[model samples]
Target: MNLESLVNLAGEAAVLATGGLLIGMAFGGFAQVSKFCLRSAVIEFSKGLLGSKVAVWLLTFSAAVVSTQAVIGFGSLDVTGARQLAARGSLSGSLIGGVMFGAGMILARGCASRLLVLSATGNLRALLSGLVLTIVAQASLRGALSPAREMLSELWTVQGGPSRNLLSLVDGVPQFGLWLGVAWLACALWLARRARIGYLIEASAVGVGLAVGAGWLFTYSVSQVSFAPVQVKSISFTGPSADTLMGLINSPSLTLGFDTGLVPGVFAGSLLAALITREWKVQGFHDGPSMWRYLIGAALMGFGGMLAGGCAVGAGVTGGAIFALTAWMALAAMWIGAVITHLVVDGAVAGSVLAEPLVDQSSGR
Candidate 1:
């Protein structure tokens, strides 16, 4: 399948691009309705509560994993959409980057993907965080910082792959998923709601959401024919962070990856949802110090996501949902980052910063 043939039959990259937008829209809607935040979810869970928000994350995962499993089992998934699914490289970024993104998410109020969803809901802090995230992503990809980042990764990487580490158990299903599901199940059991129509409906929706997201991402990733400089990508938060920044520009080419548009779609979807619910409002920090929090937090999330190679959805929920080993490592690091940030920064999960100049003492900033 040449690019020209793909262009004619699969509508070239048009279908792929649309699929990306759909992903953005689905998450955006989930964001608006659920107010989901992995950072907060972890915070609450650590504080002795399964709560509703955490379930949103689990329900989201349940939906994604079931859908992804269906896709792969049905011969519709390519298995290459996920970075660690079928690619080769040291899992350095997955582990280290996960910690970074996780911690930064705690500081920034949410992961990069969460920021996109929150920005739609009038959170000025998230909006500013998104900006910082974009700048750092570009810097990480290629800039003055690339050499150092690359060097550090080379120094610590070890040879590891997902060949038979856990296949001994099921000879199938991702190990990460198996463990995460166990945790999720435990939490779900504790939070068992009274049997009610509303509860069942919400649960079903969450399941559907997870299934659809994982299925689409996995399937579309396999469908990609553009394989020259690199393998096809499915769900990722780093490049999308850069692309989101590009869209903020006044003169971007408008002809880029679907990720470039997905962020905006998330925001737009959230904004519309908020408006219809009469919840839209222009809100923000109360002072310069608060603004500084937002800035530092956002920058941290971008850098962390880059280091982890994904964001909340890309890493925590998406990668974690799939039961990838790296996803598990990233989640651990993210939890560490979040806990440390909360204890060291200001005793606040959502660092109260937006657009003011950053404070230098913040974590990894």
Candidate 2:
């Protein structure tokens, strides 16, 4: 259906929400089948292994970059008004928040989107963590933690427009983003081939990327045709999760929009994928310590994601696709933070365990 027809029939908000639901479903299904998790990719890379996880992540990232850039290059989408580009941004918040989110994902064993996908597959740990994340995100957005988030965000701010656009910063580089995406796609394809990843998995990864691109395209299309003001945005879990949670709590006051449909759409899509693959199996925390770890991690992710203005997929893939400066910074910070945390927590623990026997001899154990 055309944008105008759909908008006329269901209203602009409903159309946007429907579009979000479809795009979110695609993302959910693709992510589920591909096992696309930035946290896993980070852990694998930190361990110095270029394995399937990294390959899958690269495929998704490259595909998202390529698809989004292609649309922009063809003049099919204009992201100048998107919040990632148009609004004032925070360098301090991106750096600190990205680091916190990365570390939290490691402790929680999943990122925001990953947690949602896992929760649908009967992971009680993920479900609880996701709920905690939503609550904390809501708190950070407008509740008890808003002041702190605002304070940190104000520490370092960048004006919107050209400054936020990384492509604009480069001089005389024509179609830079498209070319860069092409190069990345080539690399990803090579890695995927070398790793002998299944075709289905690779395709699913690409599908996830396409879904991101679709989100941008769909929203922009709606904004162009609708008389009502609609925000041109793509997929991002942080704000959407908080909004969705609040909508659930305040059903009478809920407003329909893209974000209003995204979370539930993703959940439903992931659930369907899991059921089809017979991967739906209930799982939960094994101990109190682990439960506490997840809770703390979820809280950190919630606040950090809100502070950063995006999560892993949000800033890393969606915003990165458009080459937003803060998004790239946040993405880099996430990788760095994940690597450092992995070394300190996982690596250090392993080292200590290995040294335990040597120390036991000195203690005559």
Best prediction by TM-score: 2
- In model 2, where is the ten-residue run with the lowest total lDDT? 356-365
Please give the RMSD of candidate 1 to the true structure: 5.7
Tens digit of per-residue lDDT, candidate 1, span 226-257: 44322334456667768656656746456545
Report per-prediction Cα RMSD to one decimal. Answer: 5.7, 5.5
Residue 239 of model 2, lDDT score: 87
Return the lDDT, model 2, position 283: 79
Task: Give Cα distance to truth, residue 354, candidate 2, Å.
Answer: 18
Q: List the residue pairs that clash in candidate 2.
A: none
User: CA lDDT of each candidate?
Assistant: 0.59, 0.86
Candidate closest to the true structure, highest lDDT: 2
Count of clashing residue pairs in every prediction: 17, 0
Q: Model 1: residues >4 Å from true position, as ranges? A: 1-10, 158-232, 247-252, 346-365
